[model samples]
Target chain A: MKLTRRKRNMALITMTPLVDVMMILLVFFMVTSTYLDLDMMPMVQSESEGVAAPADPAPTLLIRITASGEARLRGQPLTAQSLASALASQPRARVLILPSGGANVQALVSAIETATKAGAENLRVVRLEAAE
Target chain B: MKLKRRTQPPPQETIVSLIDVIFFLLVFFMLVGRMDATAPFEVSPPVSAAGESLPKGGTTIAVAENGALALDGEAIERPALLAHIADLLSKKPGLFVRINAHGEARLTNLLPLVTALERAGVGDVVLVITPNPA
Candidate 1:
């Protein structure tokens, strides 16, 4: 007499653990990530890549940012329009921003923006050093 | 005499759809979010329309309104922060330094730090800003 053989069923793989891990990671990223729309302005760059200084230095237009976040050009209040017209005459003027120590970062940034929009190519921020 | 009635069993819910949804959400978050070290204090960067799109990968230095400084999310003093940055510069000469300063932070605090970073031989340094104030 022949013995009867028993058939074995296939083992099913569970996805519960993988789902749990993914859920945890999703929550982690959602909680920890900041969703700010950030941009950047270059503060320092290698001088090697910069344009060489001309034999005749371009006229310098100094923009000052006061403690109250006002941009002043040559002691006169400077606006975007005024700066544009002023830059029209000497297009290659080196725009220097001398910000007051008490002024906020917004003031400095605003001054930079004004200079940039007025077609100033040689823009520089004149940083003040504290007295020892 | 009474007649007996049979009840139907509940159907098993499939988890394949759930796994697919979760996989898509996970991938979306990973792609959209930039994983950077956040400062212990709140830092709202200055706003400027002239700012260019921020490049990825850099060492961030956050400055609070009260002149408090943090390097890579850890609260640090000015001298110590500079020293740590100098060390990082030695290891990675092309290290990019980003200053994520609060909008109301004093220029005294920000400008000096930038000067120090430049003096430390950091070739690429950027001031983090935003196009929209909101």
Candidate 2:
């Protein structure tokens, strides 16, 4: 009499470890990541399109922002409407926003918003460097 | 003779579907979330409506509300930060720098650093702003 051998079943790989690893990674990213809606304002420009203030120069409008977030143009507090009307008169004027160093970032941003709404095509933020 | 009863196989819950979901979620976060190094301190960027869409892939310098500085997540003194930036510029002249200044941070803290960066030979620099005010 010949003895018959039983068939062996192949081992199945377990997915429990894979699932655990993935769950851990997902939580790590979700907890560590910050989702902030961000925008940019150019500070140091490399482009050559903006020529240096011409010798003759176009009409220039100086808007100064103080520490209290007040935008003063020619000693008057500037509103968007006022700035727009002023810009309308001199469409080609160069608008310069000079912000005091003591002012907060919000003050500078608000001043910039007013200038853009006023339709000033050539806007620049002038920074004064301290003497070494 | 006794009749034999057939044993029904217990239904197996498919883990493949769960894996597929987890895979997609991981990809979703990896794509949408920015991997910029956060500053040691809290830094909330200023809000602006006229800001342009920010481009990615640049060194981020975070400025906290009290003027604390962090370059690519490492808190550093101003001189050291500028020196490192200057070294980077010497290697790559057209390096782009992004200044993530806190909304409440004074211009004094932000502007001087920017000026130093410019003089350090960095050609392009930008200030980070939030479209939606926090």
Candidate 3:
């Protein structure tokens, strides 16, 4: 006499737990993420392609930013039109932005914006070191 | 004659489509979002028109309006922060350092910190700025 054994059915895998985990992660990322449009300005670049010097000593234009965030050119307040016209006359002039230590970052950025808009190609921010 | 009423079986609700949708959403959030450690204090970066696009991967140092300092979302003192940065620089000489300073922060607080970082042998340093101010 020959004896035959019965086959056992396989267990079913549930996908509910996986779906729950994915949903949790989605919500967590959505809540914690901030959508800010950010940009960068290089503070220190080791390998700078130094700009070549002009044939003659380049004339420099000094723009002073006061503690109140006012930008002055030649002791006059900065105006976009006046600055553009002045730059148009001497296009090769290097612009030096001398900001007071008390001034905010916005003030420095605003002054740089004005200078760039006025077609100043060679621009530099002059940092002040406190005398010890 | 008596007519018997016949009932049809209910349609099956397939969860495959639900899983597919959730998977896509999960991948979307993971790919698009930058998982950066936020600063403990509020920092509104200065607005700039000429700033270039920032690349991923770096250590972030936050500067508050009152000259407070934070590194990677934890508030830290200047000396400790510099010492920590020095240690990182020794391990990885080319570590990119990002300074996320508040818009109203004085340059006195910002410039000196940058000078110290440079003195600590930081090869590349970038300032974080916002293209659009809200």
Model 3: DockQ score: 0.72
lDDT of 2 by residue, A1-132 (tens): 999898889899999999999999999999999788889988888783356768878898899988787899989998888888888888778888999988999899878877887777788888868545
Off by over 4 Å in 1: A1-8, A47-52, B1-13
- The C-alpha lDDT values of all candidates are 0.89, 0.87, 0.86
Q: Can you tell me the DockQ of model 1?
A: 0.77
Error of 2 at B10 (Å): 2.4
Residue pairs with backbone atoms closer than 3 Å in model 2 (clashes): none
> What interface RMSD do all candidates show, one decimal each?
1.1, 1.2, 1.5
In angstroms, give how far residue A51 of model 1 lies from its true place.
Answer: 6.0
Q: What are the per-residue Cα lDDT tens digits for candidate 2 across B1-134?
A: 99999999999999999999999999999999989888899988888888998998879899999988999999998989998998888887789999999999998888888888877878789999888542
Ranking by lDDT: 1, 2, 3
The residue ranges of model 3 lying beyond 4 angstroms of the native Cα positions read A1-5, A49-55, A130-132, B1-5
Clash list (residue pairs), candidate 1: none
Measured with C-alpha atoms, the lDDT of residue B42 in candidate 2 is: 93
Better lDDT candidate (1, 3):
1
TM-score of each: 0.88, 0.89, 0.89
The DockQ of each candidate is 0.77, 0.72, 0.72
lDDT of 1 by residue, A77-129 (tens): 98888888888988878888888999999999988888887888888898878
